[model samples]
Target: MSKVMKGLLLVLAIALIAVPASANLVATSFGFPVIVQSGTTSAFNQDTAFASDFETLDIDFPVFGDGFELGATAGVVAADGVALTGTANVLPFGPVNLAFPSISQTVEQTQEVTHTDFAQTNEQAEFAYPFVGVGPVALPGFGFGW
Candidate 1:
């Protein structure tokens, strides 16, 4: 080949080697509503009811070294003369790197109507550091929530 052609080929080869492999990224969202009930009986002539609305969104980009996840739920439960309504959410932040070992954090919250006609709320957070080994070997590192 001519010198100019040879130089062009060499540059192309080096560029291909320098570029990183493509990584898969995903993003999606969905919502669902559900209702469940049990059959009534003569002895226990009361029916239980449950209804909920749930929504979730997931975005993953491990190659870029970041990800996000969110889920929320609002529901109601009633039996006999008692009814309770509640809402909950799961939110996460930080890197979601699957190829390399990394740490992630998550926060959760829940609010409910108690039997005493009072609304109560609870919050929690957690951190996890996972060890990603070769092939299929992986160790789920320690995590604590409070």
Candidate 2:
């Protein structure tokens, strides 16, 4: 592995161990995509597998005002293929060796998440507003008169 990949892996490990449970989490994923097969014209027979590592940090906290909330999240993922070992059979060659190529990738991302809602209270009297004319008779109001 290169220096950058090693450093990233180290950082991910440390973040997973040091961060709090509510803030950070680390996950490992494995997949068996290829299955061994024995048939005509098939040269290699092996069980292929893929593995990846991921780290996530998420926070949901209060904002500057009521009914307004804010959130933020950051994550990193690294994927690479694992080693494959099995037997190989060919038509002409009979039994032969098999080795499959693999690749690796690392991704890091951050996002801002937030939610805000403007809601009215149950008190209908708070919106009541009425105006009176200069004369003794009161003018008809257009606001909530309840």
- TM per prediction: 0.18, 0.20
Which stretches of candidate 2 lie above 4 Å from their native place? Answer: 1-94, 122-146
lDDT of 1 by residue, 1-146 (tens): 89999999999999999999996654432323233444433332334444454555443323222344233234466889799987433223355312222234454545443232333445454443443333344333322231
| Model 2: lDDT of residue 123 | 24
Worst 10 residues of 2 by lDDT: 69-78
Query: For model 2, how big is the CA root-mean-square deviation?
Result: 52.4
Supply the global lDDT for candidate 1.
0.46
| Residue pairs with backbone atoms closer than 3 Å in model 1 (clashes) | none
lDDT of each: 0.46, 0.42
Measured with C-alpha atoms, the lDDT of residue 93 in candidate 2 is: 25
